[model samples]
Target: MNLVESEYQMGKSKIFMRESQKQKLDTQLHQTILSRIIVIQRWYRTIHQRRHFLNFRAMVVKIQAKHTAMSI
Candidate 1:
């Protein structure tokens, strides 16, 4: 039989398939979820690192200003 004819059945609001088909779909779903999670994590890390760098730069500038004022 063809894949469409043998692999699944359609009900009013759901499609039913064999265990192997379910496993295949589950694996694909997990992979997609993991990839999205990685993207989100990378974005969060970039924002966090950028904020930390800006804070450090501001502190350095403040210290330099104080040192220059004291020397003058």
Candidate 2:
């Protein structure tokens, strides 16, 4: 059997998961894997969005602090 490895990067970090296949996958198994993949994708998106939002909020706070200092 042929074996292969792949890499996927999320944000600035790297993650790896090994997957093996020696024969055809049944529908139930395939469905389970697909659902898990979907869930992981959603989770990653949520994390990335939160990071962006926090960065934006921090920038706003910084700007407000600077403005207040200038006024004083």
Candidate 3:
């Protein structure tokens, strides 16, 4: 099965698993959760980095304009 199906299956199994068996499932679930968390974190980091770069460019343009105005 694909990733989505596997995740769904694991989730359903987790709800029905006995307490003793839960630990094993918990480990598997944690791995999946951690990986997904990393993906999300990386995505947000990229977005923030791009925004920072754009803001820096805008600031540079404003500073250059101010200097040009002072010179003229």
Name the top lDDT candidate: 1
TM-score of every model versus the real structure:
0.86, 0.62, 0.60
Q: Who is ahead in lDDT, 1 or 3? A: 1
lDDT per residue for candidate 3 within 24-57, as digits (tens), equals 6677889999999999999999999999999999
lDDT of 1 by residue, 1-72 (tens): 233557788899998999877777888889999999999999999999999999999999999999999999
lDDT of each: 0.89, 0.71, 0.76
Q: Residue 29 deviation, candidate 3, in Å?
A: 1.4
Candidates ranked by lDDT, best first? 1, 3, 2
Angstrom error of the Cα, residue 37, model 2: value is: 0.3
- The better-scoring model by lDDT among 1 and 2 is 1
Task: Write down the TM-score for model 1.
Answer: 0.86
Comparison by TM-score, 1 against 2, better one: 1
* Deviation of model 2 at 19, angstroms: 24
Weakest 10 consecutive residues of candidate 1 by summed lDDT: 1-10
Worst 10 residues of 2 by lDDT: 16-25
